[model samples]
Target: SIGNVLLLHDLVQAIPGEVVRWALLSAHYRQPLDWNQSLLDQSRKALDRLYGALHRAAGVETNGDEPPEDFLKAIEDDINTPGAMATLFALSSEIERAMTAGDHGVVARAKGELVAAGALLGVLQSNPAEWLEGEVSDALRIEVEGLLEQRALARASKDWPEADRIRDRLNALDVVVMDGPQGATWRVRT
Candidate 1:
């Protein structure tokens, strides 16, 4: 989720039940979905702030956050960076402005920017192991090399169990080991 508060607010609003609180308590901290008093207050305040901004932009709630064409270009350039996610929020303001003025160009630009931002986000968050050359890291390379050596020795000694064990260990670490005519080849599992 982009922000813990935003995600939680969305969930609570969508599903009104007491069991959700229990689920939040049991979730891992990395998947932070808890709802504290401050977050609740902040969520409410955020809604108010958004309403005010929209009201100011259009005498009523109009188009949501959308970016202009120029803004989309910048979003494309830096969307790989983690900070770009938050920067995209500005699109909401631009959308409201465009709607208030009935500017088709601005609306189109904002739509393009929103699309580019979404695409960039998807690409950045996708698996990055496919393009590696030698290895993912020095440590992982060393570990896999050691395992491959052990695998070879096990095969020579006719110890199929040992060779299988080595492969299992590598598999647990997201490394797939393949035995081929040239020897063992390994690649990271994306």
Candidate 2:
């Protein structure tokens, strides 16, 4: 049974990182972990690392640098992010049900594993609407929007250098600008 679940979890994790997060969210909402300790450790460590950068940035000292407010806000938002706590509780409840039903002995041995999976799932489930909000802020959006607006002007003026500069700015923000027959369009790189 543990092996079966391991295979399942592995399969889930093997998918795109976004998919893994979504699946974890689903799993957290449906079941509770009761399996292996090692799995739990791994999951916890991942969460620690994933949020560490944001947390560290949040604690950054301006040191009279006068960093823009918008930049500071973005870091603060990431540091204060709230994920799927509800899903984890739901998952734990499901596990309790399984245990009560005299589920396989494998589950008993894999208690930590189960919790780890649920925790991992919880960590992954973030709101898609609020997702990119943490990365690119409203200020950044305004800047991009202005670029898109001036795109035609930049091209009409035969200012290839300026156009390329705008494109480079997008690239710096992890946006890939593509030049096609239909003109330039951009997408998030990752």
Candidate 3:
């Protein structure tokens, strides 16, 4: 029986505690969970997307909005965490859309709703940049930033091959680079 038990401490040592929590809550409470690396990976990515939305909307001001009705209804319906999580992702997408449309009011309200909903689920409460980037050593940060700078120069000079090579190198280091109107920003892969 002891051999069958997966220790929470061990899991947290390898994965973010919130991610582990997310994975456990992903299934219906009454259902048996087929726990595996894939489930953890999925949970991590899902959380990343949610945090990414929050990160993009960081500049907007929230007004203490509550979780949307659908989310509350799902939780009310047999503590349906899966449904609630889906609602959270849908809200994240809405936040993204609002950000793209330059609708700061909508973005702010949706972000507040998302954070409130996530609190009910016991996830997504961390600082988005810190959570998304994880912990990086100062030396490693400098190396990654230098490489990013080089990649930027390469791209600016139309040296596509060099830029691709640098990107591949960054991928090898488990650093994901995202390009936007503000140019390239990166997060260490979780």
Per-candidate local distance difference test: 0.50, 0.44, 0.90
User: What digit string (tens of lDDT, one per residue) describes model 3 on residues 109-131?
Assistant: 89999999998888988999788
lDDT of 2 by residue, 1-190 (tens): 4544555557556433543443343333335644554554444444333332222222222122132333234335442112333333333444344444555342232333323433433443443223323356678767776886576579889998988787778778876554433344444543
Determine which window of 10 residues in candidate 3 has minimal summed lDDT: 178-187
How high a TM-score does candidate 2 get?
Answer: 0.30
lDDT by residue (25-123, candidate 1, tens digit) is 223334545566554444333333333333233322323344345545544663323234344456556655776577756655554455455454332
Winner by lDDT between candidate 3 and candidate 2: 3
The model with the greatest TM-score is: 3
| TM-score: the better of candidates 1 and 3 | 3
By summed lDDT, the worst window of 10 consecutive residues in model 2 runs over 53-62
Which one wins by TM-score: 1 or 2? 1
Say which candidate scores most in lDDT: 3
Q: Report the error of model 2 at residue 113, Å.
A: 40
Question: C-alpha displacement of 180 in model 3, angstroms?
Answer: 2.5
